[model samples]
Target: MAQGDMRDRPRHAGAGDRQMTALDPRAMRLANAETVLRALYGADALSQAAIATATGLSRRTVELILVDLEAEGWVRVRSTEPHASGRGRPARQYAFRSEVGVVLGIDIAHDRSTVAAADLRGRTLHTAVVPMPGEPERAERLAGTRRAVAEALRAVGVRPGQVGSVSVATPGNVNDKGAVDVELSMHGWTGVRLAEEFAPDFAVPVHVENNAKLAVLAELWEGATPGADHLLWLMLEGQYNGMGIVMDGVPYRGVDGAAGEIFWAKGLGLDALTASPLIGLGRLEPEERRAEATAILERAERGDPAALSEVDSFADVLARGLSALSWVFAPRYVVLGGWLAWALGDLLATRVAARMARNAPPFVAVRRSTLGPDAVVRGAIRAALDRYEWTAARPLAPERRPSPVDGG
Candidate 1:
């Protein structure tokens, strides 16, 4: 277990203060209730006193919240169990209901998009893929994506109105202003206002994030590195690269939102690699490219020197980029994920790790992603579920009232 080091504490306030500040009174109560429910959902069953202790809420407050949640069909009481110590009477236990409304996650990749739906308990119910048109106009591409997402939701018996929220993961830097700036991979996507584009039609909150950042969130939520603080997610695919940083279990999107665009590393002069050889080859249709890359991998595995050289060069460029990222962020672990990541396999990961060990500090460990290409979509679902919890718990404030019609 990697114990969280107090020395890595962010300059910002502690988690308690941050949580309280992010939510209003009603929202706070709702978030607290959701936290308790999640704990019970994970643990299967827990006494109200145990939940209170785990969530830092009073026992009475936990009881009241559980009652409200039960009324909403979001929680239920399980059979009571005796304490092992036998110091007191048997205590009632609670668990989350798994039949609540669904949430959707959309991962928009360079050449494809995946949409998945899951219930409140994070079990995937449905999934679909839409191949991205080759360098189509932006408006046309977005419209196609909207249609694909709606169709996938319908396929899973999830109506548009029934969807609580939608989370989208795109390749690039997403800022607090909700503007996504992607100059490298996702050309023509700079300054795209994600909320304004997707909110009106869906009539629900939409969270748009960088693909790498969302991958990190997925790992933190359900992957191999669960509960890990100070982690980095590196997505290696074609000419596009992305990075997501988590410090102390919280994502850190730096000022201006361009935190992990390390492809622009000044020392390695990686701009050239993004040109003809790699980008030109990757521009082929995804199927065509996948076939070609896989064939090369098979040949390399058979000891073809030429194929081995190609893989080595690709790994070298990737390692250089990772080294630059490590120098700046210095996360405890680095996760590699994306389409091309499959081709790299364990050897590529090991080579990257070796390079990092030789070039960078000794604190970081490199690991391959367990979720693979599905990570972004899973992370998106997690974000949507969080939004649903927030919205369901607290309705927006009512509009200000005007004076009476007849009276002054």
Candidate 2:
């Protein structure tokens, strides 16, 4: 193992671990295997001697666990150059077999459905996007999302059985049961159990989360907001405006998962703020709205006064919202994400930051997202990977075995 990997390799036994070790010998073996497996997963590769030293286990114990994990397809021996010593060969190094299974991350927005397939290491293998019909029925929207997931999995050449977990990021308030509690974007989306909808197809654990919250998670996972334990994500997607709150490095899904639903209230002036040509183009046909919005943004970029005025007005609305949320959350950073961020770029973010300077804390900075439009899906992948990591402590059941259509 590298020096960097060895820095935090020691495992501290907690009360649960102390209790577990008091169990039968079989339980002891399981515990030892889990410890070795966790150490291997955290590093690029570890020789048996390195694993033994890092895990505080006997060399023989580490070797036995490695053999078992390898047989179970959860570990792989890495290929290394021969040692410089003329006396013997180099010690064998083992790596976590992250490519052994796949995971799915689906993002279902009102206008489009995107699905990304990733490995256990959270590398996106393939992605598929399908445009939704305007004002689509609930069933139609769900079917489209399902088709997108299927296409993504097929492109990755992995079957549903090969997936360890599936996570969905949707535009709504999601409850603990993975059901939409409040449907903000699409009609008839409330009360829909997304986990149940996809469970039969995937035959694995399915999780659902609000897209805004997931966007915030993506920012922490892959976005530019590094080391920001307290952060806010202002979502400005089509026909939807919301806030995602994160405090102490965890998404704060308030009571009933409605923490950041301030926009829907009439008192906030957010609805009227959407009337500007740069923000709200609801009067135009759905097909024309996006194009017109793009043109208006282009005009603003070219320094058109009218377009700039509209952008400024839109920024005012965002600034007010950010100012209010900042007072409450006092976040270290605020990220502008969703379609609006992608379209407006830093121009809008800078304006919002300038407008909020008087009201918000000086330390609370605002910036545009670098994760692009797929942030929600990428966050879903992170969520699924988090869920997958928990399963590592247990043995893989026979039914959960992955059989790839081509290869991982």
TM-score of every candidate: 0.78, 0.86
Please state the error at residue 123 of candidate 1 in Å.
1.7
lDDT of 1 by residue, 263-284 (tens): 6656755554454232323433
* Reference-based lDDT, each prediction: 0.69, 0.77
Worst 10 residues of 1 by lDDT: 399-408
Model 1 lDDT vs. the true structure? 0.69
Local accuracy of candidate 2 as per-residue lDDT tens digits, 251-336: 89988788887667666667765676655333223656667777888888999998888889888887886787788789999888
- Indicate which candidate wins on TM-score: 2
TM-score of 1: 0.78
